[model samples]
Target: MQVWLDSLLALLSLPQYGLTTLFVVAFVSATLLPMGSEPALFGLLKLNPEMFWPAVLVATAGNTLGGALSWWMGYGAHKMADKYAHSSHHLRALAWLERMGPKACLLSWLPLVGDPLCAVAGWLRLSFWPCVLYMAIGKFGRYVVMTVALLYIWPDS
Candidate 1:
């Protein structure tokens, strides 16, 4: 079992799979999933430093698509909000999301709740283009800063 798992991990870590994995992982990470895409981006960069810009762009595009999906989900979740009102968490989040408007989507780069924040923005019917633009900026900025910082701080890793 361990050998099989190791082989699968090795296959995923290969250069041929690197870019596509980065994009898909980044996209899924931006969704409601608990996964993190940073390690994938960093691994790809460490393996092929020449593809830095392309990798970042691909990651940015994937993350943006995920954010767009989140928005659509929120747009479709109108009927479920009532059922969730028993939890003050959802209520407060919805209220805050409504009040902050599209500008709040800028923080969608954060961990844990950030992914849902994008969906909530969509739920509130915030400006579409602006929300997309903000998500791209934040997600791209994260890829740039976090990946670069990780490389610099943990060169041996």
Candidate 2:
């Protein structure tokens, strides 16, 4: 198992499969998963400084797509969620979501609540394209800001 893990790590190292690995990491991280993709992005940038823009764009795209997937998942589970909709917390959240509409998706870049926010948008039946657009914009900004900040903090890396 150790040997296999080592081989997998070698295969996914930044030198040979940087962008693909970053995309996968970013996508999975944007889901309900507890992982973070910043380390992967920073590692790739540290290894290949020339790939800054490409890495950020790829990461943004992957994360946005993952959010869209979460939206669909929530859409499919609408009935299940409805069963618990009578709670006060659920009512308040649902009211806020309805009031904010697709604009709330701009916060999709936030930690902890971001991914689930996308799902809730779908559950509320918000406009799909608009939500995706907001998500993309927010995610793109996050990637650019985070990557630049990481680079600035570790310039020598």
Which ranges in model 2 have alpha carbons more than 4 Å from their true place? 1-10, 154-157
TM-score, cand. 2: 0.90
Model 1, residue 92: distance off in Å is: 4.2
lDDT of 1: 0.85
Candidate 1 lDDT tens digits, 28-62: 98889899888888878887888888888989999
Highest lDDT, which number?
Answer: 2
lDDT of 1 at 87: 86
Alpha carbon lDDT at 130, candidate 2: 96
TM-score of model 1 vs. true structure: 0.86
Q: List candidate 1 segments past 4 Å from native.
A: 1-16, 85-92
Q: Which ten residues in a row have the lowest lDDT in candidate 2?
A: 7-16
- The numbered model that scores best in TM-score is 2
Local distance difference test, per candidate?
A: 0.85, 0.89
